[model samples]
Target: MPVHRRPPLPGVQRLARALALTAAATGVIHLGVAPAAATPADPPDRADVKAQVDQLYDEAEQASEKYNAAQEQQKRLQREAGILLTQVAAGQDDLNRLRADLGAVVAAQYRAQGLDPTLRLMLDNDPASYLAGARSLGQATARQNETLRDLRERQRRLDQRRQETAAKLDELEQARHRLAAAKDEVRTRLARARQLLGDLTAAERDRLAYDDDARAARGADRFDLGNEPPASDRAAAALNAAVSKIGSSYVYGSTGPSTFDCSGLMYWAWRQAGVTLPRTSQGQASAGRRVSLAEARPGDLVIFFKDRHHVGMYAGGGVVVHAPHPGARVRYESVSAMPVNSVVRV
Candidate 1:
């Protein structure tokens, strides 16, 4: 049979030849890797992973701070609750005593046998004397009524205090429960690594555990923000900025005009005072000067641990300003929440 000619588009035939020639030089497999149709470069992917990892670290940092803040808030509420409850109890006691006294006075004078009217009237023979005796009786009645009114007022105050105490107690209990639940989640994750080792044989398990311990020991040398704050070109200003931020509400993941996440606030605060800081807590920790809290001053950075995380700025008066984390706003807290790990001078 004679060959039949087939029509080719203008550039099709040339393109086919070019691809074949290119494929022959490189491998046929690599022909699929056009300049446009290529996998992302390691740098870009790495940047993404790093970004994600940074975010995770930031999240963990925030969670830890939140746990600590909720802890502090709960304690404060509880303490106040206790004090209010005590006040309520005291008020009630006072009210009871007053009521008892009033009852005794009334019993003695207002009973059927009280106020010997016949004798009293007999003693008042003249009109002037009777009028004076009548005035005295009216005054006595008025005093008793006033005493009753005062006792009722105390009782009302006592009731109000009790209600306030109860409400605050409820809030404290709820916050405590929330913090406990968060801690439990952290505990569960920590245990997950150990559980993974269970699949190993006895000797293997022992070996893995040993390796794990060694790794942990090495990890201990890792940077802890617990040390002194990083020495800054403008240390005084950084400290002042942080101190000034106290009483602010804690905001998780915020760097703040209005709110701040734990690390975010640290980052932003320092920036405001003409200093630059790392975007993540770990990075910030690595950059500061480590000092003992006893030597701490108003501008020092205070760091804590529940795993070598959570940092704050000392605001003097035993209080610190920190972003606290999720479910909180940038605010002040007592340094007692976590024995400060280290104070940084930055």
Candidate 2:
């Protein structure tokens, strides 16, 4: 049948297209080929990033202190071992001399055919002379016995020294391993911190740095250090030394004219004052007499954190000069900015 149908209207064509799109979507759903739903996610904000970065920096500082402690211990062990080695060498020389003396005495006796002194005296033509010679021989024998005893004692001491040196070497090796491990940990933590910071936008990183500086500045401005005398001349010298390094970079495990860590700053500053503070914050914590924070004076060590892994020099008033952390320079901040562990007057 030749039937001519009218062409569909534009509205009908639009409706037909809509229907086709709906059928296709239905078919996709029925075939389990619909797009997956997007799960909700809350991205980390700037504050969250800052907190994480700070935590990582703190951990890195802790590991850096451990590395410092291990290095110091290794140095001490090496020094002690060297002293022991010197002593052992000297002892060995003495022992050898003693043995030589003993050997000479034995050879003299062997040449005499191991004869009894009284028998030898009886066989000699000049009995009186023989008696005198016998007495001298007896004295020599007594001296040899004493030398033997001395040799035994010296040998014992040399052995002890060797044992001590061996122990020190073992400890030195352990310290080296610990130093390596701490160094690895510090690197790991710092890398993590860098990665976290890297994830942020450049503007966010700038804002973070700006905020940190602003906070430090505000703290410094708020604390007015009155004109108070230092606890001692050494204290004043140390404070001045620390102040001289105000903008030095905070390099982990560095103690110096250029860069420093938390405890490193204290160590170097005190050294400038003719005092040697301990190399680690924990060690420095007990390096001097403890005092109340109220009695804390310039150059006094202000230990922070429950672990005592951080330290700073009191810069009068409530401010402290310290190498704060990685990526920060040595600067002044309020002592109350961190949890105070104790105050040490070194």
Error of 2 at 211 (Å): 4.0
Give me the displacement of residue 168 in model 2, in angstroms.
1.6
Q: Model 1, stretches more than 4 Å misplaced?
A: 1-59, 111-131, 193-346
Q: Which ten residues in a row have the lowest lDDT in candidate 2?
A: 1-10
- TM-score on alpha carbons, each prediction: 0.44, 0.82
Which residue pairs does candidate 2 place in steric collision? none
* TM-score for candidate 1: 0.44
On residues 127-175, what C-alpha lDDT tens digit does candidate 2 reach at each position?
Answer: 9988777778789889988988888999998999999989889988999
Backbone clash total, candidate 1: 24
* Model 1: per-residue Cα lDDT over 64-170, one tens digit each: 55565576677789789989988987887888889888888778666633546666666656857766766886787799899988988887888888889889988
